[model samples]
Target: MASSASSHGSINAADHSPPPPPTASAPVQAVENNLLTPVALSSVSLHGAKNTRRSLLDHVFKPLVRESASADTTFGDVLARLSIANQKLARYDIFKEDSIRVFISEALEQPQPGLHLDCTNLDVSISVKEKSRLVLSAGTDFGNAEGSAYTNAVIRNILGGAETLSVNASTGTRTRSAYNAVFSTPVNGNPDLRLGLEGLRSSTQKPWASHEEQLTGGNLRLAYLADNGDSHALAYSGVWRQLTNLAATSSPTVRADAGDSLKSSIAHTFTRDRRDRAGNPMLSQNGWLLRTVSELAGWGPLRGDVAFCKSEVEVSGAVPVLNSIRGGLPSGISVGGGLRMGVLYPLPTGYSLTGPAQPSRINDRFQLGGPTDVRGFKQCGLGPHDGTDAVGGDVYAAGSVNMLLPLPRAGPESPLRIQLFTNGGRLVALKNKGKAGEGGPTAALDSRAVVNGISSAVCELADGLPSLAAGVGLVYAHPVARFELNFSLPLVQRRGEEARKGLQVGVGINFL
Candidate 1:
């Protein structure tokens, strides 16, 4: 992925959900009071490991069920209420409502491909590489944070090696052909949920060609949800990944951009918090939890988690943060379900998520969107790492959280909407640099170099940071199409005082 184009053109990276419903107030307040869910839900994928539900609450309602064994919820009472809610559903099922009928059939399967398109303005644009990434996870199980569905490929220049075989593997196979070529995989994805491994093969003739990159890897993500009635829950997944980019060969750039990761996720309706849906798709409420995770062994200094996400939010659009850790895991679990928002905004004492409404117009300014979680410090600000700064990583990993909410007293013509958001993070710098003969992990970046990198990165963020961003504008929404525009004036600055900072507009997508 490249730097996002105009935020209002098509769909920029990072996805989003619906506007804040009145019901979201509870979760937002709970977060402020330190009672809402944590950040254990970002990694969960619906198609890499198991069957898919349509929403987050597909499995978040059951009792803790932990006889001290497998439980992540803190409020046991939520379980009791959950059961009551289920019992209340029998009547609806008897009434033959579509949603109720679907709920009764645990035999219900997952959904199919759902492709979309939206280009509201020049600032945002989004497109999909494929039509649908359906997961048929039936007789299988992935993790709780990641998932996969299709097939993909990646190639790396050994920085030098083109004459030697230089191939290694664990459970799968690897093959190299003429003119610098390599093929490896586990192919389609997880067998249970999908057809086969979701992977590919590659070849390159250039040596120091294009940064002489290494550590090549790829993953095909699959997502599915029950689209039978309404309030669909996510389900099943298929995943397969391979890492061979870190071949001993050196490269133009020290580190490789390939964040090789593969995982599958699944979510099912265990019960509901408000079961009396009355056949109203929007009003129907159920508790669910979707989980997916992927772990792949590697070939060199560039080894570790390739990709991971642990997040949870309300179907209504409020995000939950995971705070603690337990049961052999390093982080806590997200406890509820919700819509996926595109932006995380900071509030006075708390934070809020932001996203535009679907079938809406897109703006050209105040754009915000990109590859996200990697490279360029702007929007795509994250990369491969398990709490470690392989290259100028953040000590606390100061991640920026943005959210969407209704703007107060804004006119109908306003292109932007007010969203409560916050961004607080520590500075990051390189602790060590790679050596000359060595690549990525081999170089030794002394304190001087690390200090310099840190200062420069911080300065860049400071110069680009949008202070107290809260306003309204034309927003775009779609399964793929995405766009948003907002005005934010920074309140705290390290040096000067200039209120001339203009509005923020961003857009992104998987295809465009």
Candidate 2:
């Protein structure tokens, strides 16, 4: 052993104790999960806002910043604030999809020394990519009753602050020609409120009524969204309508109403949608929907040739149907029901409520029955008819109940399904004693007659089950709309209502 020790050096531990664990000039801080840790927002900056206005950004971020300035605010809370701002920007339709991103880091510079020195301060940077300023497209539109090919031009963020200008032109089978221009902007830089001005011209053929309606008009509207996801809209509209180009087989009711009329009106609409999925019948297996509209025409400052008070309400609900035997129904089946009702009451024109009550006109009346409404009936078919034409009605009530089943071997993600449905409705016209009295300074309204007409109509609606239809169909939920092909039969119908016997194809965004 003495000889080996003489030949080699012996190993030993360092005497410096790992150099005092590598001490720093300042106190070391532990890295933490910033998301859960409390922190202070020292500053926030927005990037990629070339087309946006500074004032609009201030309006959106001022409140959020004030909230985040509290000492207890966590980094998670700051992220939530950023998320909300991102949503608003996306909703403005001025940003590219998924183009918003956030970056967080330690502040390069700290605020002046303060009592809250224990709080860690962080900086936030939000980056967003704007969409193209101009967009043009040509496409086709399939509405509830009409289909058309259209060309659209949109100017996004035209004047900054998410303002938009849109122009559209279209021609179609039912709509002979149409053109419209609209300018819309956020009110006071609040995305939840919008103000819009629109001008439109259209010539639409109503073959169901054996007439064509030409319209030249414009409207100013203010739309608001509440915190609970309800929407409200108020609009003032002035329109000039001409009923012309009558078919050879036009009905006397249609012929009598063929002329030019002016309508100056104010309207309010309220809507609430609480569906699990919007516009997807198979996926909307829970919750309810409601919409109401009220309008007044030719009253007070709004003076025109047509005078009436109109109200409409629609409600629908869906519930999931479960099967206990198999744990649940395959693909989550559902049952849904809907009801719609409308009324048009005559009102005196001018400032004098004593004037003779004007009758509801054809242009202002309601027409029920269609694939999107009541199945097995022709478009505008469940209403008053004269000769071969559907003259429409002043009051109508429609309802439908449907059950949807998943296709064999199809999964819940599939949009195709089988549907069994039953629907019924009735439309009635108010009996008018005579036309409006001419220049009625001395003429007075016959309140008794109006009351009687309304009462009779209501009594008739309550007298029996409405004209009924039953059907089975295949439903396809398209991304843009819903497609349905049904084999329907009219279980019961009125004398003049037109019922489609065998197969009917329907396409639109809304359905009963």
Candidate 3:
């Protein structure tokens, strides 16, 4: 029998074919392989930066060009250098977001006399659109426990070298009226370093202490970022503070410190933040943070009405309990904890013969409890109390532990989460054994007495269980701030501490 096939080719019954491997384009392949073809940078040109100084551009790009223009330089090296330059420009905040464009082409001529013939000469061009010179904004804002209406104006590249001038004014329930002006510029055209001068005037209400304070001040500040991504700031401030508007029920402690005081102070602040989500600093699914502040007032040559040394430290960390299995969302639980501590030590501006030194002032002391700090307690509630007023403290310690669970349908990326938290703290006011009679105040405290008081306060804070609270809350992480609503109760509390029961609402940028 002869089997004849049709016009079409015969198909095999068991034939199988697999899809072809993906083919990437030249640029994609180059990036994947980190293209190392020998190249040299011949020239670089910048376009569209009208307000930015040419010297600033030169300062930023000179080192990059020098590094990438070598005969042995590769295409990858040039691209990396270009990226670094772009980042520097972006950090200056002079350009619009994502408005920078880079173009690269083979150079028509090789300028180097002894250049290698085998290496390709390339030209790089960058175009950037500067942001608007002036920005004005007005809005209503909510802070820790109060709301305010504010106006802000900013002038970018004010003096052509990525300098900025900002003016702000606000009126609020707690902050009656405030005005601030700041002028800042990069040091030596370095984005990592900046210098600023600021002037501020404000009248603020402190109902927690039953007093209002008015301040007029100016400061000179230098800020820089370290190689390890830490940020640091050094500043000197000259402030005139007048404490007034005391409530009828204001405690004697508040009344005693209510007066005009001049503070000539120097301060240092250090911060390190490593969190998974940069967009919302309030809710971190992972990573750790640390911030420390130190201030010296009226010591040695620095002269001021008040004299003290103040230090504060805050540390927090978060860890994931599970990995995400969903696409485009985080579907895991996280646990976080935070600790904050502060101390204010009294210092004598000058030597005295007979009387003791003054104690830490209300403004210079540490205030411990608030929605942004130890929760479930009223604002400044964990501190030493005089009648109905929380007098703050000379030394304090606070901490919190929280478990965050993603909302059932919202997912972890939603910026909304369910939080279970416990918070506790202690605030102690230093006592002076050498008090002058029953009514009059001493000039200053003895050095030995101040030291002993601080030690005793620290020991008391560390000795026993702190005033504590526990609660469950709904957390919303807005770009500008964090908001929370919770029904909470105090689990452990000291006498005179104000504890909140039932539902409470909180709004702030930072939380314990």
Candidate 4:
């Protein structure tokens, strides 16, 4: 009985001996150790920084560490938090490239064990290389209006505060010359809130109207980003505008409003973009944009020479279609559409208190047509005309529908496609003849006579129906720009309006 008991005790002792050392993989053991051990962040240091204030870095990274574990945090948790902090620093645009390197100061010679375990108190060091702070560049750009050359100098990270200052000058065929200076900064050190100020002097010629306009102005802007990735901006601008060099063929309305004018206005814009890319649209991408603007000029105590209120709204969107045929050509197709409408009304007090109330100025009226508007007509061709020049209208409406299809033999990823489209629009002038208190031709001419004369003039070239056009085009969409050549034919037209029957070339960011 004693021998049996001794054998049993030996067996129990053998059972109690340490099982063989774990043969599990290194990663498994590391994970186990990370789950078991507690670690604390001892210190953090930044290296290779010049011109950047250390306080700014502290402001950016300190918040990330505020919630870090005081006692129960594991090594893995500390490493993860450090990695996240590094990513946050990269978003400042101060770095050149993969600009962050994190390491333990004491474990430089043995990184593997430091990464897995063995370090209870961690001292993390971050190294970053700064990007170039000053840049000077000159380039040429072409648009639907004409070609232009520009030069600009930019200073970044100004005063170690990540602000921007820029000076630019540009000249084009139609736009004679322009100079601008701009300064921008983050508001209250919050990257999402931006404030900017800009001053500019510009002169432009309108060949279609046979006139030139000179403008000098300055504006202040504030922009903020919401949590849903939408952006909103508010701006105030004060400008002096003068129309000169009017040819003998200039429209009467143009001549009336051709003299110098002062305009002070405030505007706001909101944009919500959810597309996969801003420069190019993909079949899978879906997004929409809406913009509304209201401007008051020469109204109230600070009223200027001109008095009018203009309100405009525009909306555009793109959406994927025919998704069931994933392997066919329909997979690459999308539908896009947009609508634009605007109205201009006169401010009564500004003119009533001053001299004779003038009509809304030609410069502020709504003009429609051309490649950017209704594609089958010349620029401003859909509206009222004074001789050969478009006098524009007080109200305008335009809309378009397009089906974007991939061209045959083109790869699925190609940016080239065929666009089948139909667009239409109309513009009408608001007549002000018989409203009470408004001055009309004196009682010299009978009211019937005046009305008949006005009716005859309007009926001579009136557009009873909205201009309609249908066509197809080849669209080459680049990351930064888009170009198209459309073959459009007008289905409906006005009596005296000029319309383009054949191919029309367009260049801009989008069809709408």
Could you tell which candidate, 2 or 3, scores higher by lDDT? Answer: 3
lDDT (Cα, tens digit) per residue for candidate 2, span 1-512? 00111111111112122211212222223333556677766655666677777667766666666676677877678778878877787878888859876666666675433314566676565667789999999998887866789999999998778999999999997999999999999998889999999999999999988889999999999999998999999999999999999988876667677889999999999999998885454347689999999999998889998788899999999887675546765445889999999888777888766567766767888988888899999999898887778877888899999998888888656898899999999999886435332212212346677777777886788777788999999989877778899999999999889998888888888888
Off by over 4 Å in 3: 1-26, 30-34, 110-118, 324-329, 350-356, 433-443
TM-score, predicted candidate 3 vs. hidden true structure: 0.90
lDDT tens readout by residue for model 4, 271-318 = 776665643543323577777777767766546766667788888887
Ranking by lDDT: 3, 2, 4, 1
Residue 408 alpha-carbon offset, candidate 2, angstroms? 1.7
Worst 10 residues of 2 by lDDT: 1-10
Find the number of clashing residue pairs for candidate 1: 149
Q: What are the per-residue Cα lDDT tens digits for candidate 3 across 39-110?
A: 766666666776677667766677766676466789888888889889899999989759877777766654
- State each model's CA lDDT, in order: 0.25, 0.79, 0.80, 0.67
- Backbone clash pairs for candidate 4 read none
Q: Name the better of 3 and 4 by lDDT.
A: 3
Off by over 4 Å in 4: 1-41, 69-91, 100-124, 142-146, 278-285, 327-330, 348-358, 433-464
* Pairs clashing within candidate 3: 356-444, 357-444, 357-445, 358-444, 358-445
Each model's TM-score?
0.29, 0.89, 0.90, 0.78
The RMSD (Cα, Å) of candidate 1 is 23.8
